[model samples]
Target chain A: MDWNKILLFSILVMVHVPIVSIGQEKLAMQWENVPEEIVQGRLEPQGTASFQRFPQELQKEVREPVWQLSRNSAGLYIDFESDASDIIVEYDVEDQFSFPHMPATGVSGLDLYAMDENSGWQWVRGIYSFKDTISYRYNGIKPAIKGSLRTFRLYLPLYNTVRSLRIGVAENSIFKPIKTKEQNPIVVYGTSIVQGACASRPGLAWTSILGRYIDKPVVNLGFSGNGKLEPEVIDFILRASPSIIVLDCMPNFRDSQKAEESIIKSIERIRAANDTVPILLIEHAGYSDGFVQNERLEIYENLNKATQRAFTYLKSQGINFLHLVKKEDINLGKESFVDGTHPNDHGMVGYAMAISKALTEKEILD
Target chain B: MDWNKILLFSILVMVHVPIVSIGQEKLAMQWENVPEEIVQGRLEPQGTASFQRFPQELQKEVREPVWQLSRNSAGLYIDFESDASDIIVEYDVEDQFSFPHMPATGVSGLDLYAMDENSGWQWVRGIYSFKDTISYRYNGIKPAIKGSLRTFRLYLPLYNTVRSLRIGVAENSIFKPIKTKEQNPIVVYGTSIVQGACASRPGLAWTSILGRYIDKPVVNLGFSGNGKLEPEVIDFILRASPSIIVLDCMPNFRDSQKAEESIIKSIERIRAANDTVPILLIEHAGYSDGFVQNERLEIYENLNKATQRAFTYLKSQGINFLHLVKKEDINLGKESFVDGTHPNDHGMVGYAMAISKALTEKEILD
Candidate 1:
């Protein structure tokens, strides 16, 4: 109740106002620049972006505020502003191996540098010494290049900012391009594994490996565990209009009945969109033998039978479909599995080989 | 300033005391039941449960508190307290599919019922009437089964859990006893796809299909896009003591040099922990020509070469390994893909066939 105390309290209250105001301002700024809504809940067609998964302990430590998309409309654009002169742009080069703790070692690296308008392009051997870092230092020197409205425009002369930057490494690179009369994109829609989980390198993923083999672009729509046959996602597939549609959602459906019905519905939906689009149905891979017993095996048998029936029905409907049953050849026993379900690197390679063989036998690819 | 006003205010204050006290007491009662540790963020693992992913929004809506596994515990346990006349328990069933949206529609359903307390189980037919829903219901009325433990376990339950749930469909349904020889407990550690993403059914996933073929059980550790090569996860694999380890963390790695290096390191770590374990390496499936261009194709080449080189190096060191290169059979033409990346039902089938053939040729299975 003293006058001095009152004055002190007043000063403290006044000091707290700006702090609260600054906090509000910061929150407002974040809300203003939220990630672009490509497909609202799902990824949009022809959208380009990267996601990083963190360990539970370090989830809050890594901060990636800016995300850029490489689109046909305009060249790569930094979604956020950065004042740092020397910025490290790190991204997972492989399809599935993006763990923070595991850094690439003893692999070829690439560093790309685009000089001013008069100077030509310069390339240097990138260093793969850093455990988890990819950096480019500009020394704050702005390029004398013009800006364009197009997202795909690689206009080098008017490049004021870091435009047209790409890193190419040899060990993790794709095969040489194969000239073909016709090239169609392959659409793989299924579980997280389909989306490229745990593959040590990008090209090592079955999808990516398939892409390199065919020398064509592949639209990867494998959204982690969210690959349920949602009507909206099917709509996206329809919109994308790929050459083929692969449905690999068995791992998510524990009940064979549900899996059978969903497969039928998904096939119907795709057939509704495009009758002749080749739709391949794959069965779930091997899990640890300990979890599934005789009863579980019976259930799996029922599910397998139902799947076969669907395949038969689709074939009767004159729909172009392929059924890949898990024979003894492709079984991953306890020794084959890294944990009990997901395949480790060796398992991935084996799986990719199996897929490649299937495609070859069916004469689906060139 | 007025005596009458002051008196009225005092009377009002006195009247409000009991009302406020009662409300406070109720609030305090609720707080008393709340554990102090939970309030202080020191809850046990079982006490902290993950928020369920909403199928439509793909966002975490509510957090369901669950008991965590105690330290040094071999397995996970979840308990539900219910006294209703009829109780139906449900939990996410993972590894059926990588994602929740896509369901495997063609596979049959399996149901196992425990006939006696410790005897082998009996088989029950699982009905697939509903769409994307697997349910079992209780037929007869009975007393509340106290301390009755029901473990809806799976080899790769992580991926399927996104949209899959193992529910107590019927009351008085016998709990099935798992067979011993049928238990091929292998732990799968990979990305989300291995966890079962957009799979259509529980049986159609490659992992599940393989499990059926081999007559073994699998533990799915496919963590969607987060399947980076982490040493801790590898350590978990070692402790699980699976016979084989399948490495399929390629798609998540993209085409980074760091990812290539990590792939090698992860393999080495696993081998170092336990030698003579069969490790299979998989390559990503090639993309359709429509989706990617020459530059991107080059990226795939680099990654593929890196994988081959790593495999060769590992072999030189006398490591038991297998490689699944992407065959040029499935071209990235219009007929193969639904979108650029995800394959439809037809694609899944083709993938399975390819994998099956490769495994047979390599003699990895059987």
Candidate 2:
């Protein structure tokens, strides 16, 4: 090698050393910033995490803590004490399990759940009072409670010594506060699954997951097994004046007749409320039960046919507010579900991914 | 009123009345020719409307009549009466309870709830066995002894009489029938939500829903809660030779650092395996909580920023793919969720609709 060539190689090495070192340094910094709990990729032990504990006075009467809960006119009061500069109250409420005939029964109350480092988990009804120290109330329940649990994971920033806390009822404590103003609300209306039954946590639920991802407010109008494309529900949803309306009711219908008529009627009803507001229609996921035996497969075929017909008709009628997700992409097979019906945590992740994929590919979220 | 005009109109009416009545009669006759169920907007129930009771030997262990059971493999021997036709076996492996995590625990298999004109609501499990007669099993344990109830609602076709039923384990009886060779199959891999949860029925999941719409066989590889954008998972997914790979993990990451880095790495890893497979990336839905206070709104902002950066980077690298759903269109807000998180039925519907809209707009789905 020539002397000049050696000099050039040395310069190149000298310049590349800092760049490589910078990359290593950045990686080290990231590792340092990552929380140890998540870094280990295991469920972290619930430690001294600040949480609202139910007061002894009302503890016995409350039900299990759910991921989401709501109640009609009746206020849900939660009480808690924190020295944090900022705190957030979170909860999950909706009907995912119930009788089909009782369409709106699950909308009348709130679901509440709490977890702290000290206590593993606690379930509570919607009301809590703390000796006039603090209270919080949530009003707006027209549906009955469904699903097993609704969780409330409030984020609080501490500034001083914090002891016990209460959730479920209302609270008026002097904690660091962060003010939030509501903005364009997204509204969704559909079938029972949308009500959220088998979800492990409110955050894991696709709707909740979406909310957390977008960092926006959302109002859920998912009736449990009774999402039958009723005009009454549509009217109520319209009155709420949501920026968008999502219609997914084909799953509840036993066959094509109900799916076809209800889907068309739903489109018309929603269009009457807001002509330009976007309306999305989602098809049911295809089941494999029929695939095993050729006989039951027609059900899915008919559903697809009906959905396509409805979409075509809607598009021809100049109803530009529509979208859809097919069944095959949604079902991951038997292993995807804990049972043959509801999905597991892994299933939910798949669902979110599919929806997200569809959205991105179509450029609806841009 | 003109007298002459009235008289002429009456004369014309008198002339047309008989003809109009005759036409009406013909229309009525045509209507009568149509099936009553069709006229009533319900499809006529088809196939044999009876199920063979399990043999006495099988009944020795069954507590209830198995309504609709399936065994995928041939390990458990089933013997049936020679003349028994249209027999359907239904079993409930576990007692029905409104318990939390029941769906996730796999205790509850597929349940078929049917209504009849005489009796109201009836339910049947999807798995059972036949011995000397027909018997049902609840859980892995057989009933302490055997006695069977008659299933009223579920009907089995006589042509499929003497069908073997399969229940527990991955393979065996009725549910997983023999599969025929296929030349093409679609594979989908994504986050946990895609795995399917909270859907009322197996057919309602978006993945399954999509499959039905497209008229294709799909393999689902959705893992719940475990949908971190890991290179290992991506590599595993690529090995399946899927028709398409959808990336939807932004919501799972708490911050942009993980999302951006992992997304890029995942894409690169996937590309390394299959250079030309269609890759679709999905952004997160708007957060319902953000709609309230707009806290963490920057999460999406950062995600989008990173997405755009990645898109440009990929484009420069000669990679071709699509992005689905936009933040503005699919933001999670009050109207979209029942609680601060988790989409009610309405939210799921909305999500499906958005995905469909994005696909249609982008011409990715016909």
Candidate 3:
């Protein structure tokens, strides 16, 4: 067709359907691309994919399982400000939709939270579809006050790798990316529970909860079934320049001797590199079956005993800023687990509460 | 020739494998069939399938969705007493293993709880597999006392239809089926939240939790999105001879006028037949995003207001044993929901607490 005919057709279409309002008086939607730099919780800004947890250099340094799990955007999130009443999120993931125990909402789905008038984070509900391309549509979002834009943080999938991501809002509404200021992040290096094994949603993960509570960035280096406190992972964690380092890998250890050695080495290596960064060593949040299973109870007791011994030895060597959290402190009740080993949302909240309380008691957050 | 060959093969197998001890010194396992009479929570014994919630006669009376959802073993469970240190459960399901938001553990999984020394039920953990034949193996179970057998209640799947079920224990351990005594049960009729949507496990559902709290059989008549206040379904609930009936289907209604009409009709019908049984009317548990979404908040408020009006009208009519539970009482904080509509494990607990508090306040459970 000629340019004149195309122009005439466009004019006819415009006349047929008004641009400002549709049949229901809804505003026309506009899509915006999100850049990689605005995404928080990664260890490095360079040498990694847009949503990957690890840098490209660590691909060969860490074990296969750790490297593979790092591809999941567990604790990574994007912060932005928007005035749109309706928010739409579209993303593509590279793996299966969900796990047996964990649902798609936690595995491959996105979770959204907006800042309230009091600066507290409130969860935003979205209607999601997980077909070939995942999409989340949040309707009727209101600002904290009239004529004001609201700040929102969108958490990525907890157990799936994303291929692409984009956000859509009503046309003519303001959409601004919020850059995270340069600050030391709280680094958590742990196991499947830390990586959000059985949480119903991404934002319910313990690390994400802690970040919301403290209003700071928390880097999640949690490798499912592979958080062994290896020297390679610790070296990379040190590079993040973390203010508080948490090592919670006792659940991954079956042998007490190996666990003690790894704990001492991980702490000593961190101390050697940085003198005063607070290091918190967390004992295994014992299996929920520990109440009825003597063998599981024995394993938990032995591992916790090893962690206690490691803490005592490290403190004896004049290691400062070292703290330990016992298994009892986690206090995951019998009802908290989805499986006996992994925590559901209730357990996730419990974990965040205990960790935050310990941080407060140690004056680490101060 | 067949008898001789069979005898020779059995002798050889016995010689190769010891009867009393295995490689790990575990006891010889024995399987026991769970009789239909022993399973609790179904409305009637002879009319329904072993694990079905509704009787066969109601198939023609209820809507198609309601009838189909009735096939799901949402609230059915088995009560038994055993002395074995380990327990195994094997069952088969009829439909897909899970949903997009709810996992297989809450759909087709089995949850076991045993009465402790203080008579409080404690969760028992199990390793589960959801293959063609779903199975759960709970190892190293310890009784409350050294020499006494423990009473265990195993919750069935909350969202899938069970085809068959069986329990396995050590060869010499005593396995006794605990028959549910004839008594008035607490009948709950509601929507997906009551049917255990997005729950991490079966035992975490609100009705199951309430049953444990009250130490009585609680019949769950939740029908997912089809939980409209229909007379056909209400008739089945009345047949259970409920000690207290809970109506929590406000979330399933969108129109306030229609909801008010249905509420008034339902209560009047129940009052027509029975007058002494307590009827608790629950307001809508507001959406988690209601704080930010004015549209959702409006819907919740309108529905709740309609419920309040219905309650006042019914009470003015001199309806006896009537109670109302306000939305403020449920108080599902912003973090309680998985998706905004359905309550997660934390929200489920909140729901149970509110309903049980109302029941206690009204002296219905007394």
Candidate 4:
């Protein structure tokens, strides 16, 4: 039995060695010919600081590596200067949710905006198709910003994957990368809503909205329907050591299951591993149609009841730094949902505003 | 020339004869062999009283006849009795927006809901397909309502054409339509937002929410993008003789056009036609994504400025009954739009809640 235990430990170490060796190192990528030097808008690029939450093998094992890779750079927009008349981008993608109502400019694609003189940040171009996994190259014309030097911001797809990406100006034009001062990472973990379901475009997701609102680096840990308080996922989240952690996984739980039990255990594990990091427990935004639909109301009530119980348990544990965000504060009601489950752009805005306020009140953003 | 004008009027009268003859009478349907009785949820049913705003011929001539015909019963719903074990519904539709994100139950078909014994209201079934101009039949099992008798409510599609609809119980079941106590109909005039675009289901629209909240009838005259203060549409709304009129058409105007000019003129026209009707002027919801996108912000600002000017002008004209709804009240920002233009279900709710509060404050619903 001892030999078996040793073998397991050896295997785990072997599995983790490459990941840790890459340790707090910059994300490993095959640098394209363009994008010249620095990866613009990258937040604290793992660089010897041990920031990656998953091993390459684990990233390879996930049903959708895009979800894992996608969240890392969702709100990590870049700024760059180029004297060319136009900009160009190329990216390789694995999966794309081709929702017809939501355009590709918003879904598995890229949207570019440039800072303009009088117009401020204006839309420059968007990679408006995600039907194929090949590189999506887009050409965006310059905005009315003064001078040849310009700052461009690009939004990644909300619910898709980018295997590789490269950006540059038209040939023979000047180019320079820009970066912002690092803010404490705000890591949001939850269900598909947090992963940004149905937002017309990636930038419209609540997590993305909150990122711009607070001007911070945001790591999205939303796992679609898989955010059911799994300890493995929690362990992954702990690696980031985010300044504030948001738990918004109630939507992925069954009513019969005790989210309270999973939540309590998750918090306990998280606190034991790291103390002083503020945690925000978010209750599910009750079904907006629940007002008239009784079964829906019951479902919402049961889910929230479990969440409240979990909060109560957490408070009893002497967690004074913890904060609770009620569904009411999110203000989700009859019309805030898409397909009675996911949030559209409007819903994302409400969620972002509400979370922004709660974080501000907690002084987490301060 | 006089004879020619008389002839034209005669032909127009002939074209409108059948619709005018229907009067404000109950809906005209075959009253077939044993679906048993009244077409379950219809209200006063145009029972020979001339409630319809346009003649059928006139309705057919519009750019999108569906918009006009669809809005007639846009906010209207019915309550009914059924003793059968299950429910069956049939409807004929024109188009279906089979977008993955939008549910067929919400887009081009019917949604049937019943009150359960303890559950209040439960969704029974939805006729979620609309191909061609054929009747679509759908069956839904019964909820746990007390006894064999059941009350059912249904929402019409938000963006499609419903030529006719009917409901039925089992062969030997009972059927009766329940009508509401007459309340002043609240007539709303705006863009597609008022017409219930992107609402998860029709019942979730702000206008629909207000209808349920106030327990009053509502006449929706929203024309998608065509709500740009067209005098012809107002002429039709005036035919309804509503107790209060809400003009939320500012979103439809171009930045170059003055919303105030159109608004003041619309009010003057309405007042001339019906002096005492209270008019509520609502500012635009202000694009939810406007905070980061300056161009969008400018557009919103310009539109609202014109609306404010109109509000001020109306006050100058001694319009005591005119009330203005500020953009702040509607609370729409970047996250509230479906595609940066129309309100999704969530946006509709916020809009409805804000408008409801304002109308209540002004004693409009009272």
Candidate 5:
């Protein structure tokens, strides 16, 4: 056995397991449970094994990697109303702290946003400490008015698994979980970029940004590197009763042959389940490194061409409610990416803007 | 005295000490040393104790924290011309791997950019691995023509101290360092934001972004939390023969009185040394959390008001070639920040654009 490797790994884990420390002046607070029904961005919240994306029944039905990745709380957020001037958030995640390209802030950190009476949604910044149990302290949050409860949305980690969660408000303050209606949400089924690859915070993710922009629920079914349009995943997405279904899995396709085949199959399966559901197909946002590497450029060009062919074939079969988002439509500049592949917060903004523009143009969102 | 704490610290140090590994298909190459004269961003390159920002003479003059931070390679980058299709970069940084909010990619990672013959500048994406000796492998670079050498610029780490660095290319490829003329470069002296804090990568820093837009060299003298407009630091700025001097230290000032006094003192010191250099003063870019926190909002408003008073006081004293950038000029939206304090890559773009516009409007840069 390689003791060196084991020793190094153990040390890394120990170092990342931060010791939770509360400052000298601790406020008196009443803790409340996060009601499962109030969680947005999940398709089957009730049937999940924990606070995860997939249902318990589909665990054995999907690929090993897909099932494992489904455990991540990507795009999941809690909606609530609070009158507390100071709030405390505590949660536990079942994964490593961070990645090389992405930070812990986006990987496992919690993001808070409050709805302002006059200025729309505003960000709520807090002092956070990581440990066996992660905690966030938000002090002196201004009321929307002089003295009234304000609506607050707290976004979960984009690339980590939530083990347990709770919220604490000032003693005697009102805290109510906002229950979501059965509205057909805009469903985004895509790759890591959609899963918030390198966004500095959860709210900056394209899906989250789009949610605030259209003022609607956005169900994120983004799987990192495993966003290939398989029947099992598509089956799960169809169950959401989506108002607008977006498929953006072309970047996962290494070749045009696979991309074309998957696009046709995924769309056909979706249409079989619901014939009139509006669907949006997206082309690969070309890599920033494409300018200096011909092979990199060709990957996007070929995938886009194959997508066009699939769209043409589908139209010939008399398929309606299908729309295509071209590469030009996304319009990511050379400076839009972190590592030429994953869109940073800058590129994430571009993604949200592009999707919003497309949906508005198609009259999908008013 | 604390055995458990000592053990934990030792373990963390061992875990971060990366083991350097090379791929199986290693090609034969020749390495070239980075010329110190070609390194941009440092205030003084020739007489530094090492490849650092400050000269050896001022080692005892500045505060301890400022002197320690001066060793960091925040905005440093190397300019060279190469015809090699593949490039390898290797370096060592003397610091912890990363922060809770900022990843290793920004804290200690290297970024590369190549000049396109037709399309201006392009980003060169590379596969990187971190260790005690970190390395980057960039393969299959496309030339302007079939056999032309391209101007390649490699940016160093943003928040770490560079111990050593080296570059490798094909055995017979032409490699040349670009010698910079002593043209008066824009000198930016301020706080952590100006020092490339929390940027996803070095190239995404506002100073680097502004460098590309104006196609001119920019010297960065940002000193983390120690940009207090001390006369010792201001003395170094005057030595740079700056075409334009930008002061953006309002964020570091905790109170309005301190901010107003420091601004006046710093500007006076710079004027006393060099009378005709164009000086631009920047107001604090308000925090994102200010929308929900009145105290946070007041911090920016007070600092900005104090800055305005300082600017007015200077102008009344018959000070010429002085400019004040209002808070509105650098418009950072609520969504612009990463942790409500630091600007992410998206916000970095906004910052660069604002500064570039200010420079152009003042006829400082064509």
Candidate 6:
């Protein structure tokens, strides 16, 4: 309104919300004002549909064969900067489920993380909803870490669609957007686990955890139950020039030969695209309950064997950039699953830790 | 009932439920049929007040000064056995909460485990209620390890009161109670985390995990927000005559000197009663969010210092049976918490692993 009214408003904001620092003027900006380089999830939006994540053609096509792809936001993150002592965010999520077993946080939530000079990237908080009949809004969250200059990263919804998001800081806080560097994004393509099914929050997903652990940006192309090596999806993945590509889609292959055929084809395409970029292949983290269930054990064994055979065949072809991680090394314990299938947070941590350890030991991630 | 009718009913029981091992007469018994030692947690129950966990006096006294204690079922468990292929449980709980942030599973649930010869203790499943105001029924859950005779350990509710319970097994399965040996019952006395707050299920609690890890009977005496080493509670803890006592009560010790005072008194009493029983004193798991919030960091620093001072005093007193575990060794990350205060499953595992490692290193537990 007026200058005096604006001063009164700033005072009111500081007094009412727990998110403001004294003495410094507060600054507010809409999402559109930020530079595009800071946003990382979607392919560059064109024309009037600039805010949409997927390309129009791909979005329309995905709805035909894989409706799950349109809903999954496995590898989307926005990096931002503000010198304010407090940061606030408001976001709306679409298509939230009321599943009795899986909580809303795992279903549709935005995960926040910050990186400092010493610790690299560390998780800060999750903005979630208890119920979402309409769109979900998370408001008045303040996660501004003091003492060090911080680069905050926000992971988008894991299993839901997002309508819009608005982030704010104190009136006088200096702010800027950080675009994802095109140099070498880590690319992880896998089943629902990689897409972050049943993680208590988006940040706890194994892929997200590994990304933070390795201090790099990650592109998640995981489709809930559709990470089977579709040639079309593979074509899309090839567009992202990543330093390393991780494949963990054996669980979705269903049939052993299909798993083998997909694994071979995807590896071949990736090799053709870039002969030197490291490719990491992961076997299925067989159901933990399978230890007691004979039928479940057979399903695990058959799938794992097929992946193993494909790995052996690929190794014989002198593909020096290829690396394989055995499922046993993942060592998911009986306590890891939320349901006997999708992993809980514990399982996600185990999977991330195992993958990180293997990559480090193999000299692929050093 | 007539003899023919009884025979027909037996045949019907065999036909409907998969619990029947066949060829043997079916046997069903109410919880009262089990011996007192086999049904741990509760003291003797007189008259119709059968499902009571603590003695009337303790429950009454707990509510007087420490109301929170009345609601926590931290360390209660039932030790029972049956040869039945499938075991069925029917349990009713009281004071179920509608807090959306925490689920009924963490609030109140029955955690089941079976000890096998090779694997020690393996989790079978948890019986939880998604809604309030009902008794939860777990039916047709078979946990028979093909080669070994299994004895099941059932951890009681974490935050609710159990009104009654029914245990049923296969027609041919022989069931019996295995008492906590007079020589060693792994005893853990701690705060709410040990009291199993926010754990996805009771079995995932650190105390329960350690019990399974060690393959020993355990007595959990965790009191939420009330584990300040009160003399009355200490007296109750001493009754178990355990081989070792683990103290993890830093969270409840909000005041530093008071914490130091309590730890010394408890250790003194335990040493006086049984000089040789090893007592493992644990420092507080400093808040995961403290890495960002200085106010939170100060609370952690103050509490841990108090516990450390108490440990130092105990060691200086020539209490060779005393041992200390630092919270840093626990290594809980930010994602481990559900809220800023309580740990989810991931934090529980880290806590359990750190404590177990310390105990193993000290040779207190082989």
DockQ of each: 0.02, 0.02, 0.59, 0.11, 0.63, 0.23
What docking class should model 5 receive? medium
Candidate 2, A1-366: lDDT as tens digits: 253344233222211111112212321110001111111100111220111111222223333321111111111122232322122222222223222111111222223323333432232222212122322233221111232222233321100111222222112222221222234455556444454433433444455444444544444444445567776556656755666566666666668977888889888888877887666677776543343223345676787789888888888988875777777656554333433344444455566667656655655552
Candidate 3 lDDT by residue in tens digits, B62-153: 99999999989898888899999877777778899888888889877889998887648888888788899898887778876887889898
Candidate 4, residue A7: Cα displacement in angstroms equals 35
Candidate with maximal DockQ: 5
Candidate 2 docking class? incorrect
Interface RMSD of each: 16.6, 11.9, 1.2, 5.9, 0.9, 3.7
Of 2 and 4, the candidate ahead on TM-score is 4
The TM-score of predicted model 6 comes to 0.81
- Candidate with the larger TM-score of 2 and 6: 6
Error of 1 at B220 (Å): 1.8
Each candidate's fnat, listed in order, reads: 0.00, 0.01, 0.69, 0.12, 0.70, 0.12
For residues A322-365, could you state the per-residue lDDT of candidate 1 as single tens digits? 55545344565432333234443344555666766676677766
Tens digits of per-residue lDDT, candidate 2, B249-278, equal 665566776677777777888787787776
When 1 and 6 are scored with lDDT, the better candidate is: 6
Q: Give TM-scores for every candidate, taking all chains together and pairing residue i with residue i.
A: 0.35, 0.37, 0.91, 0.69, 0.93, 0.81
Off by over 4 Å in 1: A1-366, B1-175, B179-184, B289-296, B321-338, B352-360
Off by over 4 Å in 5: A1-23, B1-24
Model 4 lDDT per residue over A14-44, tens place: 1111111122332212222322123333323
What digit string (tens of lDDT, one per residue) describes model 1 on residues B32-73? 111111111011212222112111111132121111111101
Ranking by TM-score: 5, 3, 6, 4, 2, 1
Best by TM-score: 5
